[model samples]
Target chain A: MHWEIVVGLEVHTQLSTRSKIFSGSSTVFGAAPNTQASAVDIALPGVLPVLNRSAVERAVQLGLAIGGNISRRSVFARKNYFYPDLPKGYQISQMDHPVVEGGSLTIQVGPDEKTVRITRAHLEEDAGKSMHGDFHGMTGIDLNRAGTPLLEIVSEPDLRGAAEAVAYAKTLHGLVVWLGICDGNMQEGSFRCDANVSVRPLGSGVLGTRCEIKNLNSFRFLERAIEYEARRQIEINEEGGTIRQETRLYDPDRDETRTMRSKEDAYDYRYFHDPDLSPLVISEDWIARTRAAMPELPGAMRERLVAQYAISAYDAAALTASRATAAYFEQLVAASSGEAKLSANWMMGDLFAALNRYELDMAHCPVSAAQLGRLIVRIVDGTLSGKLAKEVFEALWQAAGEVDAIIEARGLKQVSDSGAIAAIVDQILAANPAQVADYRAGKEKMLGYLVGQAMKAMKGRANPQQLNEILLQKLN
Target chain B: MSLTLLDVKRVARLAHIAVSEDEAAIYQQQINGVFDLIAQMQAVDTTGVVPMAHAQDLNQRLRDDIVTEPDLHEKFQSIAPQVAEGLYLVPQVIE
Candidate 1:
């Protein structure tokens, strides 16, 4: 029997707000154990929550970006649970009524596009960090992360497999980063996904029970966890064991999902509307302001890049993956006098290679867009051959001055002088008379060898096309 | 919902509260009182009345997103039941 995988994702994205969601505490990551934890963040008595404006605005930006309905009013409910990380016995979260009601994001799965319907996006406060076994016999709790703003985006079970889940995740990640709500840093736990995976008999209308694998940080881990969980469920079904609905944790080291808590320990999170805060109301004008303030979304921007530059969708996707990269390409192409295709090639080729080598972010790359644009301009204007242009690019990376300066310093300028190159070509043809005869006798590959010799004679400074043209003239 | 001794015991256990049988019986009565009131409200024939979540129609006030809180980890952790190495120690949290 064929088994079909059903998947849905609950993504918890930490907003890029400067302050905690309810308190004035710093939301900075990697601070000391509890240095950023304020009184209200730590749940001090009589300390009340005041919603952060930026967190709401960031959530509104996400809603607008996804074309979701932003609720005019949303309420905060206390989700009661007892965990060491959560200082408050009950976490302040939204239930039943969320800020963002419904939306869908389209993802490219193979050659087809699938749209994942977003159930809702609710604003909530993050719990603190609980470090286990840091001491002799106790767990260490760091409240620095407590009260940090989170927008928990729940998706409908629309995904079919691990690939679609990942595509949806990456698309959501790109959109959130494009909206500037979340930093999209998986390593720092800024963006993490909880994938609920299940497998059922093919064409089964009834949905099977799913086990949620928590905290799949990276795209690879998310895919691996879902695959492992799906396989485990399939084996159980084959062996006639019923799948349990439980919360599981993905152990990346073991590459498996283990049951964290079973149905027996399931806490009835007694949710009640908190009397501490009032309803969060947003006006239509506020939504309009946020929508107007948002930058061009990634999907629209990618389409524009493809249409305007006539580049392939793949190239356009690579260029518009990040706003900074797209901005850099735009500047470079603009400076190169509308050389968009060449600029796109250089960006994905040379710029990506250099960034990978240096392990630098595209935002803080050493080679400025203006500087790289100048280099491409030089190549476009026929001053530097593609080979010499690469050499110049390396020099540019190493802080070797401007493009023209590097060209002058390294003497890497292309020799396009017809007379000068023809003499060198003549010398090569006369020296390789036997090979030239072979070329005439239909060993057409010999032409490449003759041109290579002429280029070598000119110390690789000869323009390749000019050398090829002059070589053909001299041989004939 | 019907009141039951076992349901009361389960709720007390989930909330980590010790409930004697006598106290459970008393609390169950009180819970039934609230449920009765809710039932009475639900029985009203005002089908068009929209349910209100709060008493007043006031919206939540927004606070500017600024980092104004100073470090008070020392003060907060000082009052914790257990503290070690700038961390609030608790019974080991599994999973």
Candidate 2:
């Protein structure tokens, strides 16, 4: 029987706040093991947690960006659990009422767009880290990440495949980063996903047992984990065995999932409203102010770029994939007098390659938008050939010099003068008599060869279009 | 509400508890008590009412993408049980 894979993701994004959610401890990662732990973070006796207003505001901004229902009143609850990493013995999370509800994110997977419905995004405190291999025979706890605010975004089981799941996760990552709510860095554990995967026979009405895969910090791992777990469950069911609903951990090196523990139902947590803090009350004015402060989200910006700039959907999506990339493209376009397509190409192709090679963010990009704009202007004005522009771009990227200065220093100007190009074409035709004869005999393929020789003879400075026309004229 | 023998073992295994045959009868009674309370949740008309995962409509807060400090070598290693040079010491299994 054909099997259908059902996937839902629970993404935990660490909020980009200066301090911990309920304490004033610095939310910086890689700090000393216990230095950043505040009184409330360690659950010191009689210490109270004061919710950071900035964290709340960040959450409100995210709700507005995602078109979620902003709750008028929400309550934090103590999720009772026993773990060494949890300093409070119970994690303070939303139980009965969460902060955000009923939002949807649209992600493009392959050639189709899929909308994954978000069940809720709730505010919760992160647990401390337990380093198991740090000691000879024991583990050590690092409280640096403890008490860090996390927004757990839960999605409905609308995803049907691994590609859709990855697309959904990536889209969420981009949205969080664009809203300035999270850093969306998977390596630093700023953004993590727990995927719930199950397999049911096609046309089956009832859902199958699911195993929740945890600690998938990368998009590749999320897709792989879901694919592996879904196949495993289907195999088990086909072999006349029942699927065990449990929590599993993905081992990236081995590329398989092992059972971590049995999944806990809601009643197992014994969730109750946290008594120390009052019910969170967000006002209309607060929502309005946050909404007013919202920047253009990815979807809106993508539409605007496509409509206003007449760029392709792929280019627009690539430009708007990240906030910094979008900002760089917009700045390049603005500086180049609204040459949007050229700006998009440079940013997506050349600029992106350099950034990836250097492992640098767009904010710290070595090539400034102004320098890139000048190079584009030179290309548009025929001062520099397309080939010469690439050379200029590299020089300016390496030394942070002006585009015009680089162009002048290298003497890499487009040979657009008809007389100069015509002379080069004449020399090429004289050297390649047989090719010229073939071209005149209607062997159209020979034109490309002559054009290549002409370009090479001109030292790659001649514009291909002008060289092609001049070469064809001389050939005919 | 009563739990069959199979339900008792499933719940025990799901919770990662070791339940023996003698204790299975007692757990069966205890789980039935818990299930009786949960059965009340089914009585409420939830056909249209959305199941709530959190209390408020808040998203995750993010941090600035700035490197605040260099890698701390000795300070982070100080809390480890064993350390050699800059690496944490672990028992050698193969050797």
Candidate 3:
């Protein structure tokens, strides 16, 4: 029997704020144990939580970006739970009223594009960390990350497969980073995902038991975990056993998942409105101001790049995958008098290779856009051959020197002069009499070999197109 | 409001507590009492009303993409149960 996999994702993005959501304590990670904690963070006696205005504004901005309905008034709820890491014994989260609702994100999976409907994006405070390996048989708590603001974006069960889930996650990661709302750094635990996956028989309406995979931070892990869980559940159902709805943890080392707890072990989280903080009321003026400050998002930028530069959709999408890469492409294009297609090629191919070789980011690239632009222009205008241009690029990248200066210093000008190229072609034909005879006897493909030898003798300075023209004239 | 024996067992398990049979029956009544009060929420029509998740209409705050701190090796090891040359020590498993 055919079965369909249903998946939903709950993504928690750590708000890129300077301080904790409710307190003025620094939200910086890796601080000494409890050093960044304030009275509100640790939930000290008589300490009331004060909402951070910046955190609220950042959520509003994200809601606007995702086309979500920003509620004018929202409330915080205290979710009761007991854990060693949770200093307050309860996490302050959205329960009944979230800040944003009913938005959709479009993710491209395979050759088709699909929109994954987002249920809601809520605000919450993160719990502290427990150091289980520390303190001689006793776990210690670090409140540095406690009360850090998090935007929990939940999606409806619209994804059909593991690929779609991964695409949706990547799109969300890019959007959050582009909106300046979250760094989307999975390694730092700033952005993480909890995926709920279940399978239903094809043409059946009833949903099967769903298992939630918790805290999968990497895209590769999200895909692998969902695939593994779906197959595991299907096998269980086929073996005359009912699948249990439970929370599981993904073990990347083992490449499998283990049951963390059963559904009965789930926390009721006795949620209620927090009394200390006031209702979050958003003003129309604030919305308007935030909207005005919004930058061009990835989708809009990709469309613009495709239309304005006459580049393929694939190239445009690859170029605009990240804000830094898109910015670099734009700078190169601008410097090269709008040679957009060439700029795209260099960025997606040569520039990307260089970055990977040195393990460097585009922002820290040693070669400037203007210098790369000069090299591209030289190749286009026939000042340097394609082969010589590559050498010039390497030299300019190593030392921030002028492209023209490097070309001149190496005496690598292309032999675009017809008379000079024809002389070299004549010498190659004279040396290879058998090749000449073969070319005359309808073996026309041999003409290419003669041109290659001529160019090689010219030390790759001979323009291939000019050499081809001169060689053909000499042969025919 | 009264708590049920089932509610007591479920909540105790969630709370990671091992309840005795006698304690389970006693806490059942306590949980039912809480549920009866919570049943008041069902009286209001929430059909079209969206479920609330948070109180504040706040967005997430973002930071600049810059590393702010140097790598802390010695300090991180200070709290470890056992440490040798900046590395945490754990009991041998394979050998």
User: Interface root-mean-square deviation for each candidate?
Assistant: 1.1, 9.0, 9.2
Off by over 4 Å in 3: B4-95
* Candidate 2, A112-223: lDDT as tens digits: 7777888888999999876666365655666678789999999999898788899898888989999988988789999999999988888887778888998899999998
Q: How do these models rank on DockQ, best leading?
A: 1, 3, 2
Docking class of 2: incorrect
- For candidate 3 chain B, the 10 contiguous residues with the lowest summed lDDT are B86-95
lDDT for each residue of candidate 1 in A1-476, tens digit (9 for 90 to 100): 89999999999999999999999999888988999998887787888999999999998998888889999989899999999888789899999889999999988888777789999999999999999865888999999999999999999999998999999999999889878899999999999999999899999988899998988999999999999999999999999999999999999899999999888777799998888888999999999888889899888988998888889888888888789999999998988888898899999999899899888878988888888889888988899999999999989888978889889988898999999998888788879989999999999999989888888899999999988877787667
Which candidate comes out best when scored by DockQ?
A: 1
DockQ of all models, two decimals each: 0.81, 0.08, 0.10
Per-residue CA lDDT of candidate 3, range A339-439, in tens? Answer: 98888888788888888999998779889898899888997888987678778878977994799888888898887888888888889999999999999
**Rounded to one decimal, what is candidate 2's iRMSD?**
9.0
TM-score of chain A of each: 0.97, 0.94, 0.97
lDDT by residue (B38-65, candidate 1, tens digit) is 8898788988887666777878999999
> Backbone collision count in every prediction?
0, 19, 29
Candidate 3 accuracy as lDDT: 0.82
| TM-score: the better of candidates 1 and 2 | 1
Each prediction's TM-score versus the true structure? 0.96, 0.82, 0.87
How high is the TM-score of chain B in model 3? 0.56
